[model samples]
Target: MITNFLLDHSALVPVAILLVALVCAVLGLLFADRRRILWALAGVSSLPVFALTLVPTVHTIDEILCTVQFSVPTLGAVELLANVALFLPPVCFAALASRRPVTMLAAGSVLSAVIETLQALVPAIGRACDTNDWLMNTIGAVLGALIAAGTAWLVDRRAQSGSSTGAISS
Candidate 1:
């Protein structure tokens, strides 16, 4: 079943993933600040988003149409999970890379919607636009934003505690 997925999908997926990794490594070297590095990573992470969704794949339908189906639980667990995982890392890096998690979340949500719209409007992409995919992606983005916020809070709490002890010692 897993191998069947590759038959219809673009063969360049593995190559794209590797290329994204290389780009991230290159960007990491160029950025000095931690937040800047994270932002670069976030941008690099979005490569897969386009590679996966926009790449032309083998299609059975001869006619191209733009249609959106509402979120339906018809997809298999694996496909659903994959959709969610797709957006998670990018948004996580984006939120962590910036002072504004909400802005990142909004951007992520809009990105998801735009991707879906592209799939619908562009027939050459050989991908169907589905609301379920957008919904799952948004959920993943939300989770990523929450994780970033939580991580920042924890780090701040630790730093504040350490500073308090240092101040007392002084």
Candidate 2:
């Protein structure tokens, strides 16, 4: 029933996937020291989101030819927000894995560019190759990376403070 609902409302697919990713990310926080769990969860949850992004519909090569356009005329604020939301998990997970903001940002931006390029080059994919999506996706990635990095930093700082206080008390 849930699958059918998501299929019927294609826009809901990414939202659903994002929710699942968030759950995994929260679970990952429990194992903050071992980032591998975060990576695994994000990777596994991201598969469906990736598939949804590449899902083939009507063959429309016309969109691919216009991939350089910075703005999508048909897209509204909601769509742009959704684009950003869709990529948050992987970006956050990448940050957790390395705690490197630059690495996470680059990875997210590169991944978005690659996906857009693939959509443009592959006619059968039926996905629109829009530069706006790349922009939004990159923004999402950076945002997620910042969030993860900040959280990790806070955790480390708290631990350090606690250890120091303990030492002072001793």
Query: Which candidate leads in lDDT?
Result: 2
Q: Per-prediction count of colliding residue pairs?
A: 0, 0
Residues 77-168, candidate 1: write the lDDT tens digits: 44555566577668767777785678888999999999888787777768888788888788768766666666666666767899999999
lDDT of each: 0.68, 0.71
Q: How many collisions between residues are there in candidate 2? A: 0
Candidate 2 has a TM-score of 0.76
Model 2 lDDT per residue over 1-170, tens place: 66566546766655664674565356546767887877785687467558867888766665445357565422235556566766777777767777786787898889888888888888777787778888888877876777677668777887899999999999
lDDT of 1: 0.68
lDDT of 2 at 4: 60
lDDT of model 2, residue 122: 80
- Candidate 1 ranges beyond 4 A from true positions: 1-33, 60-76
After the best TM-score superposition of candidate 1, give how far the Cα of residue 125 lies from its true spot, in angstroms. 1.6
Worst 10 residues of 2 by lDDT: 72-81
